[model samples]
Target: MNTDNGLAPLRHRNRWRFSGGTVDLHRPDLPARTATLGAEPAPVVLDPTRTAVIVVDLQNDFCAPDGWLAGIGVDVSVLAPAVDLSAQVVAAARAAGLPVIWLNWGNRPDQANLPPGVAHVYDPRGTGEGIGSRTAPSRAPVLTKDSWGAALTDGVGSAPGDLHVDKYRMSGFWDTPLDSVLRNLRVDTLVFAGVNSDQCVYATLVDAACLGYDVVLLTDASATTSPSYCHDATVYNVRQCYGFTASTPDLLDALAAARPLDAGHRTAPTTPKDSE
Candidate 1:
């Protein structure tokens, strides 16, 4: 079916061709491999040196067992697993000397810059009873924006080399400094992990892909208010539209494989006399 953007519908067609007791497509270049009887292959490899891991909106409202949304009937069971997987991904990226950018939803008290209809969906109470109060302790860079309940929740801080970019819309690229930050870091690939897979995460990935960055969504490192929505948005839509989706193990393997060998090179040691 067509989506809200009026895109064409997807079709499923199965055609069988046999030649010499083997199935083949019309094209000779098409291998004799079976098309519908095997498991899907792993995602493509992503170079760590040219990659940046973006942790988006992992605040208490979404990740914590008790937060504003906790009162709602929203299913949050996936938050813990997503958080755990994200931590592992972050560790791997750090080890590889890649940049880790944390995108938090920071809101202002006045709420002047929030998007037009955002606050209607998520109203911020006077007591900070919204998405802004949730925070993690990873010290990742944070961007605080007053657009909706978009401020990074409390308790999350920035690390030694993290960056925070404030945004005013669902996509991080809309009038934000995200592009400049990625360009400055020489990052050509984006590894996305975060909350609301169907909403913010989906928008960001689509925008990144449109901006020509190789995007990979850590499927296990992100979630939505509903499991079905998360799966459809992250696993299905991202794979079909924006980029590839991978689990933590799959991403770790890709990063490990992308590592460079030492080439058996060694550095010379300094003399003891020179120390004196």
Candidate 2:
């Protein structure tokens, strides 16, 4: 099945390969690498080849002690636990050959894209500390692109093959290429984990469900600096309304049980593919 010459197009759905004289658009014999998750809202199932883990806003601006939220006097301790847990879940997803996508809030320097309502969320009185007011303590403009605050939490590992999406709004799908990226990767199932369980993570999960992607949230790997009830409600809502919820440990066990070399481990691409 060496497709170096582009003779074999991986025989998978959504993977359109082009070669010297032609484009292979056939969906004749796609492979379904099914992996079962011991998820709540019933035992969830999916094709590992068509699944991806979307790690949302596990960034310093939200999880770090000196991050934007913390600097603004919010207790980031509650969100701190999501850092290592997200890393663990991401590692398992990578080993299983599932694509890992890091979706963080990387705002523009001028903040032209942000509307009045969105900007008002953090700086109610327009105190000049919200989205793009700058003057950050960490030297990196608060959540601005390529800043310290927007970078992934120190321990969370992202590889060369991992995809990174910068979101403008709370929902990653809004005004972002996230959905297109997932579709191009031939992914239909999204596994979610990140900080602020009631905010960005939940918003993105709900949007994903509406778009018809089978979503599964890793509860322990996603937390919030908000009240405990907010976190709990998000988990319950995801299982009851959006998609499904499962623990990180459970996902790891399921991934181990469904270890197939071609299901994103040995056979998955080492570099990002512009098109599948």
Identify the leading candidate in terms of lDDT.
2
Q: Per-residue lDDT for 37-71 in model 2, tens only?
A: 89888998778777899999988777777778878
How far is each candidate from the true structure, as Cα RMSD in Å? Answer: 16.6, 5.9
Listed per model in order, the count of residue pairs whose N, CA or C atoms clash below 3 Å is 18, 3
lDDT of prediction 2: 0.79
> Which 10-residue span in candidate 2 carries the lowest summed lDDT?
1-10
lDDT of 2 at 234: 95
In candidate 2, how many clashes are counted? 3
Q: TM-score for every candidate vs. truth?
A: 0.66, 0.88
TM-score winner: 2
Q: Candidate 2 deviates by what RMSD?
A: 5.9
